[model samples]
Target: MYRFLFAIDKEISYSDLKTLLKKGSGIVVDVRSKDEVDKGRISGSIHIPVENVESDMSLDSAEFKSKFGVAKPSLDSSELIFHCQLGRRGAAATEKARSLGFKNSRNYAGGYKEWSEKEGK
Candidate 1:
């Protein structure tokens, strides 16, 4: 079990997100639903809908380790960026990610809605 005292509301710009996605240095977890994703997404974001986070709302770290069945290096943090339709769900997902021990997690405040509006996509 973990507790989070600080909350994240990192307002990520669309251009910045594009840069990161190009770098492929981390994973972009879409916290939105499948329908939302089908509409359009950040090209390569991994869809892990916020509603199906986990049984206890945890990242699938332990499951990954077990399934791989190897002495894989324990993750200190997952370079995760979460987004949703608007900023609200992203903020909530950020809090949940922090509680689940994801240190480098961030909330893309300018989520899909902002991105779409900005790009006219």
Candidate 2:
């Protein structure tokens, strides 16, 4: 059920992401490493490095909760967005999240670089 919905690849633009952020409508995940995130990141985004994303892990798994400190979004959540330093990692993370049953997950293609430079993060 959930898998069918998220099977499609979706990309979110920076502007749309800003709107979503202001609305507080979804979860934003940063897929950068700790060192990169320690430098700076999008406000309100959860830190989950790409390496930590297990392809076989389910969103409801205890391991996922322990790692992110939040319950995984239900299959219907369209607000699950992922980003990274440049975008590649974020895309990978999005794929992982989808594989984990987050069918509505999306990748912020502009990433932190574009977000900070253009949006003055």
Candidate 3:
């Protein structure tokens, strides 16, 4: 169990993710491929493959909602947490998000593998 009392700049641990999910305090962005995501994913996560993250983020609110079924996150929101099957692509997405002015974006370093194994998902 972990208690996160501050914003994570770039990386987040599995425990931190669990805490965030429990609190419903962040957006968990799944940057995995469509096939990978279809197999399994963290419930309530929004999917946007790593390659499309930048363009998707640029979509206007209505277009974004129409495409993703969720409102577009503001560029400055600190709750954009990106993850993939493993951490590599997630790190890339985190970099892209930060480059696009999402300064508080973070990556789940332990990834879905850790999440599924630990959470029995």
Q: Candidates' TM-scores?
A: 0.70, 0.81, 0.88
Error of 1 at 82 (Å): 0.1
Model 2 — which ten-residue stretch has the worst lDDT? 1-10
Candidate 3, 10-117: lDDT as tens digits: 999988888888997788999999999999999889999999999998888899899988777787777789999889999999999998888889999889999899
lDDT (10s digit) by residue, model 1, range 1-121: 8996764335566777777777866567688998999999876676767866543234255764464332222234344678998878887877776666665577888899887887778
Q: Per-residue lDDT for 41-80 in model 2, tens only? A: 8988888778776542354557667776666777668888
Question: Judged by lDDT, which candidate is best?
Answer: 3
Minimal lDDT window, size 10, model 1: 68-77
Better of 1 and 2 by TM-score: 2
**RMSD (Cα, Å) of candidate 1?**
6.3
Ranking, lDDT, top scorer first: 3, 2, 1
- Residue 27, candidate 2: Cα error in Å is 0.5
Instruction: Please give the range of 10 consecutive residues that has the lowest summed lDDT in model 3.
Output: 3-12
